[model samples]
Target chain A: MATWLLLTLAAAAADFQDQDKQGHPTRAVLLGGSGEAHWNAGASVGSPWTTVTVQRGLRGGWTPLAEVQAASFARWQPAVGVGKRWIDRRWRLTGEGTVGWTLQGDPIPFRGPAAELRVKGGRAVGRFAPYLHLGMRSSRTEDRVETVSGDILREEARWETTLTGALGTGFLLTDRVGIDIGLDLPWVHMPNPSIPGMHIGVQTGWGRNQ
Target chain B: MHTHGVSMVRTILPFAFLIACGPPPKGVDYRGTRLAVVDMHLHPGDWQQVPESTQGYLASRFPFPFGLRPEQVAEGVLTGEAILDQLDDAAVSAAILFAVYAPRTVGVATNELVLRERRADTSRLWGLASLPVDRWDESSEAALAALSEALDNPGMVGIKLAHAHMHFRMDDPAYFSIYDMAVAHDAPVYLHTGTSPFPGTRTEPEYTDPAYLEAAIATHPRVQFILGHMGYDFIDQRPGDADTAIDLAVRYDNVWLEPSALGSRGSDPTGTNLPLVLKKAKTAGVEARLIYGSDGPQSPGFAADYLERTLTALEAADYSVEEAQLILADNASSLFGIPTFKAEK
Candidate 1:
């Protein structure tokens, strides 16, 4: 489902970019890595995750984006949102808000809706851009079969919130392609799998000149 | 573009610096506090040697409450070497092995097997001789002789009796000689004082009641008596048996409560009635008399789950690290006269 969502978004973004007479950036990015990559390899909790996102520049400083995250443990999430960017001299400021739904099917199948807000800032030094991002997400589940600490128990919908932050440097390989490396810190305190204290993620993106 | 870069940096750098300098991680470091773990109740015997009828009964009751499956019980039967490997994986310093003494319903695990295993690694394994009351002669000479022989073995630290399966009252005078022998040798006497899970077994709860041990405890005041299950009444969930067990421990300085069946309900750190037992023991001011016991290797996955759940439960209940340490190993070390890991260190 996440893959299909990504493909659909990519197609829509490509069509929008082609129809516009003015050259605008149309970007596709891929995110893939284990949450425990920075910690011991054996200490990984849950599963490795991959995400794909497509963003199309709109009028003014606004951009519309869509993303999908696919993971082992039968987890899938699809999100859509709009972002605004402000460029002042050598730095760029960005903010985005997304609403998504999560589906899981390990111990038992369950689905939940989630909302996230992210803010980021980056400064371009020649071909490299170093950036920092802070994000917060809140999720709530519908009534589903719940596995409470490994025991099968039926529970009503519940809400959970997580805070995430990242620091990274993006290298512009070409005018249309770039690579990013970052440390992702996701704070999840619930009694789930052992969440790694820190994780490293690498993402690649292709885009046209703005 | 230059202004854009400077403005963005100015807006985000301070926030980034603040977040990067934030406090480390919240929550306690559960693994940092090292505690020597000693499992005071482990049935490390070959289940293949179990009676055919008993095997059938266990097999039919697949998925026992304590996360034990009959197939896993058969598959998990470990040799002496395998037992050591399990202990290493669990970070357990030592374990007390019990030979099941239910001769009538289930075949007895010979004292010879337990002695041999303990002798193989005396530092890590301790043996408890199982005495069959039915095998005792009219004068109880056979029971006394067996207990004496077991105590003679350097690896045998105690004697275990199954009153439920053996159909003998715990306070029966016929077993007084065995208690006397334990006192003479300074060995603790372990009794199965709880409900057995075997459905078709000939066990009588009345025979195994914790209250019956009062007379025996009084009679053998010098001998240390360890209640194997703390008089757990699993079927009825009655608090009476457990209260009696705690009262006995509180009343007698020589009595201890070993919660072997505490982890029988899977890995819900707080599952089972163990926390209740701990709370009661704390209130009774006999918390030091509480000991840890897995009663395990019952299934392939049981031992680890048992140890993890037990520790997690203790930590979750806000048990002081010192109190948890005592229950984990110190109490057992003092009661059995075994050298604790701290002493060796």
Candidate 2:
């Protein structure tokens, strides 16, 4: 998904530069990494799972972006997302949506689509521009455990989801390439029925467009 | 050299300045203030040899309330390093390592090996010897010899007797010989008064009842009697409390209680009933008789974390901080006749 997103965004950037009659994009490729949903399926036979994503930015804001990404963590799923960047002098806004599938693991097969909206602003340095981001995420799971031994032994599969808000900062390596690291906590419900808990994720990613 | 000396002076100056700037403090004997406590009940498992299947079997047959799963037991067994680490972290002075085994022919060698290993680490490990009561007729000599040798090893503290194995009452005239040996050696006898995880025993030792211990205590008043599990039965229809047992300890100064199974076993196996035991101890005025113990590896409730929580619970049970210190350290020292009872700094 990340690869495809990057390629599409790069193509869009080239077209926008040509249309501007500048021949050169004032914006470089935005290289950034992200953590996306591997699977969010709840405790049932078939629930959608989410993956964590990290990415790199290739250039400045204003060019559209798209990518296809395979997770190094969750073995059975892959994803693709596309979005456009609207850049103001010092501020950048990005919107993207992703779709993917997770293979069945002993108990559950997951399938789902997710959407992300992000806004970031920061001071730009020579090759190091640090920016903060805010975004929202949601996912579901389907899986459960039952007592095969007797009726009295009660075991249930759990399903959970969350609404999340994040505060993070990343540095751009150059006009087209840089790394972003951020921490996000889900305030919504967690699927594991044992305890009401929260998850914190740190994501990093990079990209390039000509 | 001059520049290096100046750099050293610069680094040292702040520390000296801080000390000089502080008010003069009261001189205190901090070394002897805190007691060094070592729990005697620990089961370190041999994960390499015990199969997961075996562990599963152990768990299913003896569930958490009865027994911990093999992995839990295995973890408890290998937990020596972790326990030592916690002890180091918690400032525990030493630990008396012991094991739990059923009364079977194979159990003899296993128990002996455990004792030998525990004895090897005399500096920190006080190996408690286990005896197979059923095999006493055949293995008594071997058991006696092994225990004598281990006790003679300078680190081996005392003898650990589990009632589940013997099935004979504490008052049984037969155990007198064993008591005689322990008394002769000036070694303490730690007895388990609890229900066995497995059935099938020779006599179903009724003497485990705290009431029965009176006769033995009366007769062997000089022999140190360490009542393991705090004289309470894990599955007793009529469990004895600290009040009944404290009478024994108060009557005979030789009598003591090692709270090994305090957090595990009993009807409320999760240790929900522990406060009751601690209460009875405090009420009975036997708080100092309680020692830090955990029937480990076999009992799921006896972990390092459990030990900490147990102490916290005891402290909360209105036990005086000093009494809690004694129960956690001084009591075990007095019972085992350890001279240097203070926590090592």
Candidate 3:
């Protein structure tokens, strides 16, 4: 599934590159809902968690994003990503990739990184736009300590991948003000342990592009 | 500009309403049944009586960084009502208190102190007589006599031996009589089974090794034994000692492992070692033998943090609420026959 998603992303990137190269003079900031489902040893463990993301767009269609997420098990993850966007008279699209790190030291110490890919699309109305997003992510976690002689003393790691989708409306209140509300759903991809979860978020931002 | 501000408010108001009415955050609801906590290892020292040199020794051994004077260390010692206050604040229903009897390393907090405190509140404080068998005249009979008298205190739940600090092995003949008395009384025996990093104290790992207790555990199956620290060697990166402890717990049905100082041990605030130990227990199918202990209030403000960390780790590991309840209190409650509260409906 990860291989398929990676190939699909590559094809989408190629298609975007071949489109008519047109640049818009605009800068925008955005806030939205984010979330993920985590699995270990082929079992659904942690509860679903809501996450908040803040993003700022730069010139040349580049945007940088940051997010924070946590759950009741004292699980916490903070992430950062960058992406490219394309906008037209009645439609907007974006593709982003991010890296995240996990922290929770008991039952076991989890130390590792996760990489994600997100593609989003929106339809423009008078001043409000409703959007949908599809994303995929993979994570690698391990806890271990070793001796100076390069002996593996203790080690434990779990790898997982998830698919996510979201629905939301973006409101352009003025030339420089906007607000966004969204519901995020994430599905863990594993047999006999398909735990699903939902998260909602509201984000308000200011930028000339609105 | 005024119209633009009004438009912004109009747009933001609905978003705020949506947020206010939205479902609670994901994964925020813990399904595990909450159980009353019983702290199994607490050393409420008589800090004022400790000599300046010993205070200095303790300060040096402070798990986290220390910048306090010896007097400050002494002043910070939680005693009398202070111990109760901390327990209340941490929501711990009861604690098993131990006297410190390593006379050579640190002056004794005589068994009398533990008995006295336990007398103040038997329901909330259980006493464990600390035996400095090494300090007793080299006669097994003399040590057994001292232990027998301490056990005579109805409030004393068990005997605590600082084998590592006093430089003695568990299987040594000098302590066999004390073990016999503990078995006769049906009192559980608590042994310090890990290496300590204190600068002035004896730290021979062999003396505290869990493997050394094999013969004793086999000979005295009636006497339950709690291996404090699960034989962890905090100063080292390897898991050899901890594995040894886990192996012992797996091999001996009468043995249980308590991760007391792993979280409070200053060095690994993240307590990565705990998970490793828990993972091993699960693999060995010995989760029932794992108990919760906070070697604390000794390091003020540690009880709460340690409990939170242990619970979080347990939850993250996919341990069922029933399992969490067991580790949190049921195991210790059943082991020591202490009463615990049930989850409120």
TM-scores, all models, native as reference: 0.54, 0.53, 0.54
- Give lDDT: candidate 1, residue B323: 87
TM-score of chain B of each: 0.82, 0.72, 0.83
Please give, for residues A32-89, the per-residue lDDT of candidate 2 as tens digits.
2221211111110111112334232323432233433222122243445544454433
TM-score of model number 1, chain B: 0.82
Residue range with the least summed lDDT across 10 consecutive positions in model 1 chain B? B60-69
lDDT of 3 at B335: 79
Deviation from truth (RMSD, Å), model 1: 15.6
Off by over 4 Å in 1: A1-210, B1-32, B60-76, B135-139, B200-205, B237-240, B266-272, B343-345
Candidate maximizing DockQ: 2
Candidate 2 wrongly placed segments (more than 4 Å): A1-210, B1-35, B45-54, B57-76, B79-83, B99-112, B119-121, B197-207, B236-243, B264-272, B297-302, B339-345
Model 2 chain B: weakest 10-residue lDDT segment is B23-32
Give the CAPRI rating of model 3. incorrect
What RMSD, rounded to one decimal, does every model reach?
15.6, 11.6, 16.7
DockQ of every predicted complex = 0.02, 0.05, 0.01
Better of 1 and 3 by DockQ: 1
True contacts kept of each: 0.00, 0.00, 0.00
